[model samples]
Target: MSDLTFENVTVRYGTRRRGLTAVDGADLTVPAGTVVGLVGESGSGKSTLARAAVGLTPVTGGRILLGGDPVHRIGGGGNPRPLQMVFQDPYSSLDPRMTIGDSIAEAVPRRVVRGSVARRAEVTRLLELVHLPTDGADRYPAELSGGQRQRVALARALAGRPEVVIADEITSALDVSIQGTVLNLVQDLRRQIGLSMLFISHNLAVVRYVSDIIAVMYLGRIVEYGSVDEVLGDPQHPYTRELLAAAPRPGGALLAVPDDDPALLAVADTEPADPHHPPPGCRFHPRCPVGPLVHPDRQVCLTSEPSATPHRHRAACHFAATTDSATLP
Candidate 1:
C-alpha cells in the first residue's frame, strides 16, 4: 500500500496567462489504507484534482508523489497502472459491446496473468471481489443494472491492482436505493484491499459516509480541510457553512426559493469565479455573506488572500478564527 501525495499541485488548461486554472496549488495526501473525501460545488475543481493525480489531466505546476515516486513520470505507462479511475457514469465508462469479463480482463496486467484459462479465472475472481456473480462476466455492461455496472467498473479498476483509486462521484448517477449498495461495496473493497482512495463529490453527506478526512474546495482552491467531523461538523469557511445549510435533510421543511431568501439569491446571482480571470483577494469574498457584514474581517478579505493554514483544521479565511461554531448550521 502507498500514500498519494500532492505538493502545491496546480493544473491549468491552455496557456498559463490565458488558460483556466482548474486547480490552484492544491496540497493533499491520501494516506495508505484510508479514504479522503473532496467536497465542493460544481466547477470547484475537485474532479480536476482527482484527474490530475492519475495523469488524465495535465499538471501545470508542482508534482504528485505516490509511494515516494513521481506520479506524472510513471502514470503514463506501467504494467499494473498505479492509479485507476472509477468515473461518475458507469454506463459511459464501460463498452456496451464488450462482455464484462472482457473489460475486466483487458485491465489485467500481462505480468499478473497469461493464457485463456488464467485470464478467465482472473475475471471470475475480480467479479467475486466486487460481489458480482460469476455469471456476470458473460454479460455485456448494458445488460447489467446501474449498480451492477458500477460494481463491474470497480472490479475493472481493481484488476490492475492499483495503488490509488480515484472515485469521481461514482454513486451520483445511481438510484437512491442502489447508491447504498454501491457505497457499501466500495467500503468493503477498501477494507479488504486497504487501497488509498480519493472520493470526490458535491454531496457532503455522501462524502462524510466514506471519508476519514475531508477537503472543501472553493473557486479552485482548498478552503477548508480536516478530519471529516472537524471539517463537515464544524466548518470554518463561510462557503462550507453555506453548503451544509443548503443541503436538504430528511423531514426538514422545504427551503425557501432563492427569490424569497436574500442570502440564497445572493449566492445564486453571483456567478462562479472565472478560472481564467479569478477574482482578486479572496476568490470567495464577492459572494461571501460574512465578509460584507463583518467589520475588520471585511477589510482583510477584500485586500488579502488568506493562506490555507493549519490550526487543528486548515481553513483559508481571514476571519476563520473568529467564526463561531455555535452559530453555524
Candidate 2:
C-alpha cells in the first residue's frame, strides 16, 4: 500500500457558469496502512470527495494520486486494481439476484478465479476473514440480515485485494446492536492486512474509535486536520469546538451560543448559503463563532479566505494560532 493524496481536488455539478462546487480545492492524505477519518455535517462534500478518489465522480480540477501516479491510470477492464470503496447502504450495495459466492467470485483476482476450486476457496477465505459463515456464499443477499449482508459487502471488497479502501458511512445504516461487530471487523482487517483507508462518518465517537487522524470538513473545505487528540482534545477552530460540544454526552455542556452571536445563531437557526453561490471570503464566516460579525471584528474573514498551514496539525483559520482551548464553547 502507498500513500493516497488529494491535491487541490474540486468536484462541481451543473455547468461551469452555474455549478455547485461540492468540494473546493481540498487537500488531504491517507498514509500507507493508516486510517484517516473525515467527519462533517450532511452536504459537507465528504462522499463527493470519496467518490472522486475511486473515479466514481469526475474531478473538476486538481488530482487524486495513489502513491506518486494518477489514480485513474491503474483502474480499467480486467486489471488488478488497488483502490476499492464500500458504500453506505448495505441493502442497496449488493445484487439481490446473484448468489453471494458468485458476487464475491466476480471480484476475485483473475488467476484465482480461473479455476472453480480456487475461486471457491478464495470466497471461503474472504467470508471467514469478515467473520461470516462459509455457508453464506450459497445464499442470496436477500437471505442475509443487514449486518450479515454488510459483512458480505466487506468480503466482496477484499476479494479485489485493494490497497486502499474508502468506507463511506459503512456502519451508519446498521442497527446499533450490530454496529460494533462491523466496526470491530474493520479494525481487525486493517491490523491483519495493513490496509490504508479513508473512513468517512458524521459520528464523532465512531471516527475517534477507528481513526489515526481526524479531518473536519465544512461546506466544501477542510477547516482542521490533526491527530485525534489535537482536533478533539485541543481544537484550534471555533467550528471544531462547536462540533465537539454539540455531540451528545451525559452531563456535558453544549456550546455556549451567546444571543448576540449572529454567526453561531445562523448555523442553528437558518439554512446555509447555497453551494452554487457560496459566501465570498470565508464560506464559513456566516456561521463562524469568531468571525468579523462578532464583537471584536476580525474583518479579514469577510474579505479574504484563510489558508491552511502545511503541517501535520494545522487549521485553515485566521485565528487558529490564537484559539485557546481554555475558553472553549
lDDT of 1 by residue, 1-329 (tens): 88889888998888746678889888888889999999899898899998888878888888899888897566334378899999999889999999999999999888768788998999999889999899868899878899999999998999887898899999999999999998888789778888678999888778988889998888788899899989877888888887787887668833334456555656667766676788788988777756753344467777788988767589999878766557444
Using alpha carbons, what is the TM-score of model 2?
0.94
List lDDT for all candidates, in order. 0.84, 0.86
Cα lDDT of model 2 by residue, 192-224, tens digit: 898788999999989998999999999889989
Candidate 1 wrongly placed segments (more than 4 Å): 75-78, 253-271
lDDT of 1: 0.84
Clashes of each: 0, 0
TM-score of each: 0.91, 0.94
> Listing every candidate in turn, what is its Cα RMSD in Å to the true structure after a full C-alpha superposition?
2.7, 2.1
